[model samples]
Target chain A: MTKRQEHILQIVKDHGPITGEQIAERLHLTRATLRPDLSILTMSGYLDARPRVGYFYAGKQAGTVISERLHKMLVNDYKAVPIVVQENASVYDAIVTLFLEDVGTLYVVNQKGYLAGVVSRKDLLRASLGNKGLEGIPVSIIMTRMPNIVTCAPEESLFMAAKKLIDFQIDSLPVVRPAEEDSRQSELIGRVTKTTIARAFVELGSEPFL
Target chain B: MTKRQEHILQIVKDHGPITGEQIAERLHLTRATLRPDLSILTMSGYLDARPRVGYFYAGKQAGTVISERLHKMLVNDYKAVPIVVQENASVYDAIVTLFLEDVGTLYVVNQKGYLAGVVSRKDLLRASLGNKGLEGIPVSIIMTRMPNIVTCAPEESLFMAAKKLIDFQIDSLPVVRPAEEDSRQSELIGRVTKTTIARAFVELGSEPFL
Candidate 1:
């Protein structure tokens, strides 16, 4: 879509139930010239125009149209300090950390502060129920390894980060900086929880009314 | 803000790094007429204008400027089928339901399908660790009862529902239908989860790049 069309979508999203004449006036354009753009937006499902109420935003379609503001928001500003545990920590200790921190996932960091693995409450719960001793068992045995762990860059938008969480069905993501230009290792910086995106959405209030 | 001012904000938010001339052209207005609207939006913390890069969104303020789509989105369309259990059910049974459904919170319902209370994983965990017989203990003993439960109506906006969850620091909200105009009782129909809001935010993506 053209930049003008995207801008038009944002206008409808922010101030809807607006009339064509008003939209034209806001843009300083003739209603005749603005009509095509409005029609395109409506036909594309990004906007909806009422007979007398004017135009409003339609709900999302497959591969939703994300706004530029959200597309540019950096993860660093929104990420929370990650709750971490040593790789060798015992299951009992991890459970304590989980409750004390009130976090759904924990990052397992190596001695160098590089992300080693990840562990969830379900992992701890399952380990606790088995015959193995909670204090004796190291978290490494249950933690998901680095190769399988999902991580996000500090520069990525909340949109992409949130999509990763939804696509993978995970509750949180570790925000990291690449350790070297070519290395696979990364330095864990912060964490982005589902709550973070939810809070932002509440503040944004851009979704279509159902 | 005036409709014209809000529209100007949308323009800057979507096509930032765009010149004032470009904004004027898109809206079909003279740069002179658009100048005042731009100044007002920027001064109000809705838009940010750079000397070289044009304009951009200014992130959220105290009373977040919510989008019309979000203000219109009702809970009925987004709420999921509520995972519920009887208040009289055994604690052991409640745990089973929690795992089988894979939900963070459960709505405790009375005999008439009206919401009675709410139960969380922490509540069940604490109840199970004690000397009490899990099979004999009723959820009513541990669940948070009515009047204290946080809930939303199907007709309410997702914006309001999301605010409630954030304000209360809760993971989920039970969507209910009022039993009577004067009664406090409501029949639980669905649930709004953090995951749900997070996913919706990703789709919305109207927040500014911070």
Candidate 2:
């Protein structure tokens, strides 16, 4: 987010029910410029912006407001659309689907749509070269096992997901709900990849309207 | 990295002793088409090209081999040197430095050159609005504590540095020596930021060398 965006949040937090024009003036930006950001935060379920009225810090103000864009871009937005691949699919098929989708990784889920093991391009490629018949071998043979799988909570920020990819040196992250009290598998919610983070960063940094 | 680059790595990893002709035939690309990638990778230290023999992987393979151009572009190789502010400096001074440097953040270091904390553009802007006395307010009051700082290893991948920024929701990550068991503070090294990631991504995704 821009420095002006942070200042806007602070203003709304400190002085609620303030006009966009005032914030624009204070930040040396145009109301037209601020409108889109306000709309985005509102759409992401953070700040509440009202027409002819003003904006207010909403839903655990400290956590949301400005950085929600950062958070949403990380994991929440990716979780908004979950991608699934059957656990029994052949490794080659997974690779094909990956390339076709232009994604660096794919999620392997159980029949119930719960997350099983995760597979990535590197894993699949490595498996393909193995003497083992990859055409007959299920992705399970090469998949990154549960617990070894790095995941992100829906409420977590994009920064967190990006962190996982970087720290783990993996290309993608599976977005999953926390596992049930006693269950081994976490709910398969969605997926996020390095490209997702890169795209979001571009999106946020891009002055599309301007 | 592009799919072709990855394909080459996979080829080397799968059949290390294989020749360039074999890879070109395997990928169905003419040797001429692949020569540029080979030259680029070899020049960047990702691959060691033998005069008669084919290319072989070189150095430590870290997850993936992003091009040196991408590395230089994304890690802010040109502008990543950390900007230090003396420990006793006021938040106002930090603001002037940030503006002068055209950077999003600055580091706070003591007389002994040990890292104390960090002051970001957002922090300074927030402090600026708080009160007239902010000019006298020590940066330590507003800076994120040192022990809480996120960092990167020099040998780390660009993706790793990106993770620190995204995960912490902080604008900058100081690269540091891994802290010792008994110690709390890490030795300050270099710095990474959002702009670095964006620049690198753009370069990596762009055609031709950056």
Candidate 3:
């Protein structure tokens, strides 16, 4: 930590639960000089000042939370399970299947079963409304394709999964595993969800160390 | 919900905190017939039963977790804050800068302040060990560049951010806001990070709803 950062934190610790003006007054610095540091420190996870309020130390001391820990805790583990749909299945059949399956989204697969694209319930609804000739329409038309799929390996941690969810603004990740029978065959294994991450986080926060 | 699914959940709710066999018996189902459905339900976020014992409703049913909330969260409300290093700055200077700043990564920017690529602490560590001529090396050579930058709009919700993080498995999200003067001039405004999301989850779990 810089000498200035140390001073800033020390001031917060000693007279903390204190306001920014109070910090400036004690440190012999202007509020403007303190503002950038306060923003940086708070954003970096060192300071925990509420908006329009003064700063305070987020933890007993700073410098432990890493992007890696955040990734594991929030992502790699807590996602939804994925199911693939074959192209031969009719759109109506697919729709009924999904309703029976009760899933928000489904993956469209090629004959060899590689990921072609994804179909969300909304897409089906939109297609139905579009008069795109539902019976003649295939899911491939609306699906978001590969290089676009946000996927992960099963071995990665839950926090990694969470970071992707928050960073890219997606709902879930497809977990893929190489099929033993054929090296090129990748199977959709599981999904990590934001809700799962939230639940895990609750469990973790209640822990003493974490 | 399908009658089959309702039946399955009911059996678990009634006999469970009980075994899968009991659920099978109550539903007049073979253990084989119920296994796949049980697995699918558990994986899809509907049921949360433990293996070898029985299942329980383990997802947002206990509380409206982030995934449930994610359905309504948008993509434009967010801002991605990026960490940048000056062009002329040496690797040593950058290292000290990162350490003092308490940030895990930094983006190397050109003179115009447009993003170049990213440089992580790990990349610097690897650079340090090799005799790759550190002093004169501009931070640019090591960065992960433009097309590589996964960005989000100010309108995005924290859940959307979570999805990106999970999909890409990246550490930080550089939130961007459109420039007032030029529509093409998108600039860094805020950042959505793993720590930030973790803190949010912690905050969510602490709510009285749980």
Compared with the true structure, what per-residue lDDT tens digits does model 3 show for residues B1-210?
A: 568887787665444445778878877889999898888777655565544545654322222333334434443433335667876677766776776665556776666565556676555654554334667666666667775788676677766676676567665677776566665645666666655565465434334322
Among all windows of 10 consecutive residues in model 1 chain A, the one with the lowest summed lDDT is: A57-66
> Judged by DockQ relative to the true structure, which candidate is superior, 1 or 2?
1
Supply DockQ values for each candidate.
0.25, 0.01, 0.02
**What fraction of native interface contacts does model 1 preserve?**
0.41
The candidates, ranked best first by DockQ, are 1, 3, 2
Between candidates 1 and 3, name the one with more favorable TM-score.
1
Q: Model 3 Cα displacement at A200 (Å)?
A: 5.9
TM-score each candidate.
0.68, 0.36, 0.38
Model 3 C-alpha lDDT per residue in residues A1-210, reported as the tens digit of each score: 568877887876555546888888888999898888777767654556544435655442211222323334433345566666777665655565656665546777788776667775545544443253456667677777776877777877775565566666665577777767775656776766554564464454333322
- What is each predicted model's overall lDDT from 0 to 1? 0.77, 0.63, 0.60
- Order the numbered candidates by TM-score, best leading: 1, 3, 2
Docking class of 3: incorrect
- Candidate 1, A1-210: lDDT as tens digits: 778778777876666657889888888889998888988888755566556657765543322223555676678888999999999998778878988888778999987778999998767655654234678889999999997999898989988999898889888899988887436787899999888888777756643321
> Which pairs of residues clash in candidate 2, taking residues 3 or more apart in a chain or in different chains?
A74-A158, A159-B166, A159-B167, B74-B196, B74-B200
